[model samples]
Target: MTDGSIQQTRLPTRTVVLHIGRHKTGSSSIQATLRHNQAQLLQRGVLVPKNLPPNLSGFFSHVFSRAPEALKFNVERGHGRQQAQKHGNRLLERLAHELEAFTGNRIVLSGEEACALHPDEVAQVRDRLGPVLAPAGQQVDFRVLLYTRDPVAYASSAMQQNIKKNVKLLEDHKPVVLRKAPGWYQRTHAAWAGVFGADAVEFRSFETACAAPGGLIGDFLTAAGIPPEGIEPQRANDSIADEIAGFLSSSHVPKLPPDQRGLWSAGFDLSTADQEILFAIRGSKGGLLTASEQAGLWDAVAADMRFIEREFGITYGAAQTAGAVPFGPVFMDDLKAALPRLSPPVRRGLLAYLRDRSAPGDPGQLQPEGI
Candidate 1:
């Protein structure tokens, strides 16, 4: 029989707060705040892991996604199966090492990709975590935090977020596949709950979180059992306006002269000045999507919406709040009005793209997807 002292020497329960964002629920902001205040949180026994793969945002997708081979990080570099598995193994090792070294009682792993994981994937991660802790005789308790938005709003925000990264060469002027509905809330969430147990998973309302004390970051930290004091909230919105997103995918890019047209052929990082200038290209203040499109999209997501309401009493605002508005003829007019505010090169490039695109046979014709 083992000595009673061995049992007494076991490590105290370590609580891991897994913030699996359902996207566009201020996940960027929460991550930013958590990362920015890392030192302060560490003092209070809460940890935002400092050592892990560089882009931890994609960590879950790299490891748990059904199609790891197709990831941009993999495909762009021509990395395949072996590289992906190696990366996954490395991440698991890093996590185990970090947990072993941390002085803190609570660790926060914030990544929206976790919300996208399938059931088997969830089980895989859960199983790995336990074994990693087994060797050290450490017990772990998980608190899974998810923020669910109104399905219609999520679809709109998610699509525009996709447009921000699309290079013309990689995709046509449409979302690869429009999410006809919101996330499979019932299926995927239940999967997470099953893996971690229902009490560990707290699917909160995005709308309610926003109205809380320090807003989303506060609500998240509270749910995670971290002290919310002295941690400043931060916001990170990298998305372009829907109109600009629509414009990028419209037939106009195909119309540009070879010199100007090549801009869309590859992806490159924008300097802060250029990025801010790009953000200036805002869509209509009145909002551009038609009522009919909104209605149909709602019809598609209504069942998921009802499931959340019935199960979690989750009310994610209304469908009319947001939806993707494709490029209509009016979008060109909006761009023209904003031209005086644009820098010379951007103005010239857009004008040239427009020149060839406008034809007598197809005046102001646009071909954005999800029309």
Candidate 2:
């Protein structure tokens, strides 16, 4: 689908819904739901692309066009700016073609990476599509949906994912995350609003949406103007269990050099019993936030949360301002009960780690804001 193949044909009037993500907000789940219900949605006059990248879970999957430079080069096959823009223009052409042929009243194009697009890139998107969707008697609306989460929770989840990707412990990489954490949720949404009219932007709290009647998927369908009846929600990208998360946070497995880490993980084995024990400890541990740390992070994002609530007319669990307190010292009784399942080395490591981390940290130590 090159730029040359697409003609500058005017598309029929329709509602364009763009889901720009603040990541770690269950965008994956939403995308999966959208894919699963593509047929039903089309039947209901909501057209969506049938061939989105399943692996990336993105509506459009050209790395050069969709990702930022640093991410594109480091994570994907590196391409120059000219190449990216060229490819992006091609994608817009395809999008225009799809819209031109679409008979539906609504068309949805969802991609989390779109949230990272520069203003100019966004302008390119609008300009490229604007001609294709010019007013045609029927109303033409361009709307963007953005889902936000609490800063601490989002960061904690992002940290978990980052560690999973690279061979790095939480401590080794957390400093960078805390220092450059994405606290600009408000700014990001504002950028989209500026480009696509304030009235055109739809802001929703991921937490609140997840807690809604049908959970995240249900709430997203409702937001997408899809009826939720008969839709079976499937959870995607499930997080590692809390105790295992804690172990991974402290362990050097992911922190090993790339080669060694791969080999270690490949050869490493865990018993069914140990796996069960670890799974049992799920929800026992959360983000490494002390009572004070949680409160501080919450306060830092208080303004952002307030802005979202005021602008979107929705509450994002205001009552739950603080994250759960960090786990207290390991209970010897519980530890003893679980010792039979763990390998000797793991058992010893857990004992030492727990013993050493029993005491509360120094209150004077610097902590990242809004993390």
Candidate 3:
């Protein structure tokens, strides 16, 4: 038998709920809900860090002294790694210290990228956070909250997301495969559990949660241990309009300022007609996935799904019917509207410019000779 005192169990004066997003898992909605209800959560003895940017660095800093290279990839790929890292340590440290100093509240830090980190990186986070609470005479408990969608459904949604983002690389894509298997989830969860312990982790199905008694927002709040009363369902990071995506893809490409250039560049590689066809196929609601060449792409995704389930413990749910969301027509309309405004030569020039810019060049050739 053990003593029942707070000190005996190392009960955390602060509770850190890390919502490592598995991407395309309604992470934005969850983050938005938490942000909107920060005050209410605090009133309930829960401290969701407000100062921290909705990114992973702050959470990662709690696990490691320095940012990992993979984190840099996430940053370079426009995941806000650098910006998040910039204030990660300060934000987490401040939250931890403040919660300890002021109220015996639990600090909940939620971000989806936390789920994508490598296992070793997760371990570093656990160690870093563990010591901070120990020395402060407070217990630190790490809890991971995540949602899994049916593999096919997740893939379908994810593909739409990729198309919206103009992402070109099919090789790095993991939608159909993730739906078919659980490897991605298993790896991500394993990373967190390895560091924080399995008991500290919790998993929920987004599909089920969404269809639960009150819907996704309600389910999320309940899962986070918050009462659902008076909680407004705050939707965050919803998809941009298809016209907006088209405009961004065209006008916003070459002219993006230096700081923002990298983001636009990371979209689809349009060098090949097949790539364009794939993009169109994936982007369309009723787009066929079984064209002669496209079959290979689908096969790849299927293989990936198998790998994901085998590795991550993620399971695919029933397939959801795809709907005509009007993104494609809107994108096309936006493209046409933008095209007539530019002269033929100017259009050709723009295409050439983008082609040249996206093409591989030696590091020494970063700046052209005659500027």
Candidate 4:
């Protein structure tokens, strides 16, 4: 019944889904799913571009390529909106050109870093995207999906991640307490929704998403109105064991020289044994949660749950009722399984690699003659 060119029919000229990630959630899982399902999406008359590159590098490259002045202030003064209008215009042009060249059915550009933009930046983004999508005779629908978790749990998990990446936060010095202040979600989501309208913004709890029987990917697909079946489940990035070790080694424990510390205070490429050591260290340091603290944290999380539901108008209990699963058990199993496979030499080599990578200047300078 529809009469349109194959280009128009196969490709959605107007609508583009921009998944702006609110970090420490299941953003990785969503990105992985999209990457894995690129072909399947195309078959469904959707195009998720693999050539879009990863993270802010490619995005900034595309933006700065057209407007070189955009990065000048951002790099020098750490101010992002130095040349907002020019940058926005250039970005729109680049995206339009790329979309036109793509032969696939639908075009999906995803980057978690996009969530870092301010309100003004988001407006700029919308303005840029509008022109790019207009030429294709497609209506642009900007969908902002954010996954929130219990603040206590999120902080703990995030600390672990920071240790792995060797990042240190000022709050690491403060006692771990559940504060009820507005967080990244409030700032970032509110900004985008202000520009894009509340209906276009969807927020889900990461805890619920990962709890599903089919895991994070299934939950996201269901939310996005995409069929979950037959999509390959790629391994989620940033292992939990590494995350724990990174946290303990970085923030909870005494500080080390920058070179010795993990990038995010989350150590990289940690094995199962490393996680066990980390847990043991935490126990020794009285860092393991007391039963009462755990209960209190959960209570705080419950409060956050209520808040998100009221604010975002989304449901979180569905996946929980359907036999919700916890990630701790899976993490423990992975650590245990990895132990026997790591010989002493391999462990030493890994340590050296981590140190060398984290070290300043050329790590080769510190390397032994034989190495």
Candidate 5:
């Protein structure tokens, strides 16, 4: 009986879903899913632009292209946002043309680094999209979606990631210096709300979203107004096991490229007992924060947790009350139990490491090179 039932209907409405990530919040999985399901999304009248980089996080650099002053000096030097904007603008213009031609109702773009931009820089993004989208006779709905994580957990994970990338946090004795203390979520949320209007900005807890029926991928699909019934939620850029991550993060270990490092993670065929050791190591919180720092971090983020609970209607379990030593008796027990199954050099290293720990005043003894 509807008009579309008798004849083909050109979708007139278009929605722009902007996903700004606070990093380490499963943004990769969501991006990978969107990239993988582009065809399906198109069929459903959703346009996930093919012109954008395969990893949508690359779009963050594009947003930053015109706002060089806003980029923090320490981290933004190499992102090449200025040069990238030229390429991105061309894509955006092309996307505008495509949006006019395509019979789709939705467009999705995502980037974690976009959340790093100041409010003024984010306004530039809105300015770019405005003229293009405004020309459409149909209504334009622009929305911003942000996934927020527990500050303590986010900081711990980010620290581990930095170390994995060979930042030498431990070696430099400045591991926690760069990490923002608490209130980051509030500040960032305010900025986004200010730019997009309060109603247009939606906040979703990363923990809750990831734990939803279809995990992060499904959660994001649902958020983008797409159905999640038949999609696979594959994790991308998965973190390595704690023991493996620990080994790579050790001060003396040489840094390897990400792909090569991933190979190391894949190559380890851990047994059940070995898994127990790895689990214990992981439980140690990536060995990144000292106990006092960990406790204080939770305390600092407590207010944000309350705000998240009240504002987002999501409540998480209380943060850990105390910090744990990076390695513990469980690690030692599992390591000892699994030693015979390990390779010769690894066995030698583990044995030597244990021996050195037991003897006092033996700081530099038998620290195996190829562990």
Candidate 6:
């Protein structure tokens, strides 16, 4: 049946939860779970809007982005400001329509890109979106949820993610991540808290949340006022394997910069077996930032680490030295086993990468296995 034909409905006062992500912090996992469990969530009076994708970054960015032309979404569409403005207007209709049809008493909107919105833009979101989303004669409470991790770790993982998606990030010839971790956190905190009121903002440690009872999804559900019962947890957007990241750090680039970078294509191929091997090595590497870089990251972010502790009541523990550790044995063993199975193209690429690494920080390089 058509949406128009379906009976329109109204519900009680709603809490519109906006989970703004500070990326690399399990946002993908939460979005995936919510997207896949839409029907189940709706049954319990939570609307994960059908009109929109699970990640609302595109939606949010179009509305608040100061530079629409630079947005990956708009750039991909060949959309300049005029087109982006037109697109944002189109989203409003969809937003209103979704809210008009929503029977649930709560809404959960997520987008990692929203983490960077300015305070004024956040208020713009409130002013513009609140009325369209509120059910008739019911109050709409806006709550912002943000999950953060240790500065060093967050940057390390984020850098690896950049390289995985866009090999060309290597062009900068700088540290894969810059020393901006501290400012990144403070800005995100200010953007949300400055408008929403500190009381309306919820901050959780990503590592802690993932380690808790039902893991990240469960923790998020509880934070969003949903019962965790019977909702299966999810995992998504696994970072490139540690060994792979380490390999890239040494072999491909002169330097890896923390600033944003991307690519249109990888210029390489990964067959099913190669893809499987990539999946298998995910947790086995870390400390992608070299020793000097890791220390610099911590030094830069240390003051804010204390600020976050005092202000948000969050604390990050010690981090490992960069470039000192070998990619985990698990990565070594798994790749050793999977090497024979990789497609010739991927196998050749791996062998070439292994042969040309510029540094010797890792002792467990696959040459030991005679690949």
Predicted model with the maximum TM-score: 6
lDDT of 6 by residue, 2-35 (tens): 6765434434568999999979998899999999
Error of 6 at 149 (Å): 0.3
Question: How well is each residue in 2-78 modelled by candidate 4, as lDDT tens digits?
Answer: 46664556535455566666566767767777878787877876666555543433363335233444543345544
Clashing residue pairs, candidate 1?
Answer: none
Higher-ranked by TM-score: 3 or 6: 6
CA lDDT of each candidate? 0.66, 0.61, 0.54, 0.54, 0.63, 0.74
lDDT of 3 at 71: 52
Candidate 1 yields a Cα-based lDDT of: 0.66
- Kindly indicate the candidate among 1 and 2 with the higher TM-score: 1
TM-score of each: 0.77, 0.72, 0.62, 0.61, 0.72, 0.85
lDDT by residue for model 5 over 1-371, one digit each (tens)? 68876354433557889888868888888888788888887888777777676556555555444554334431345435555556566667766776676676688888888877778777777777765754545557888888887665676667556544444333342345334657777777777788878888888888787778677777888887888976666677655334444554442233345565342232333344543443334224433555677676767777777777787786665445332333445554555555566655555544544443333443433244311
What is the C-alpha lDDT profile of model 3 across 1-371, one tens digit per residue?
A: 54666457664455667777667767777777777887887787777666566555335543453453335444565545455465556655765665554473465666666665677767766776666543456656666788876555555456446655555322244434434343565576667778788778777778677778878888877876677888778775444332223323453333334465354344432334323322332223322122332344434356445544564454553333332233344444444444445545444443444334332332222133311
Residue 29 lDDT (model 2): 77
Q: Model 4: which ten-residue window has the lowest total lDDT?
A: 318-327
Q: Candidate 5's error at 240, in angstroms?
A: 2.2
Which pairs in model 6 have colliding backbones? 175-256, 175-257, 176-256, 176-257, 176-258, 177-258, 178-258, 242-285, 291-322
The true-versus-predicted C-alpha distance at residue 172 of model 3, in Å, is 7.8
RMSD of each: 6.6, 8.5, 10.8, 10.6, 7.7, 6.3
How far is 105's C-alpha from truth in model 1 (Å)? 1.8
Candidate 1 structure quality by residue, lDDT tens digits, 1-371: 47898887878887877888877888888888888888898889877777763226677777667677777777767889789767777877777777676676777888887877878889876877666643456678888888887655565566566556545421332233234354477776788998999888888898788887678888888888877878887778756665555445544332344565333343433345544565666653223234665666567667787888887788644437333333345555566555666656655555655444443454445333211
Q: What local lDDT does model 1 show for residue 151?
A: 56
Q: Per-residue CA lDDT of candidate 2, range 61-165, in tens?
A: 343234533443323556655665556556556656656656777877777877866666676557655556544545567888888776667766766655444
Identify the candidate with maximal lDDT. Answer: 6
lDDT, residue 350, candidate 6: 65
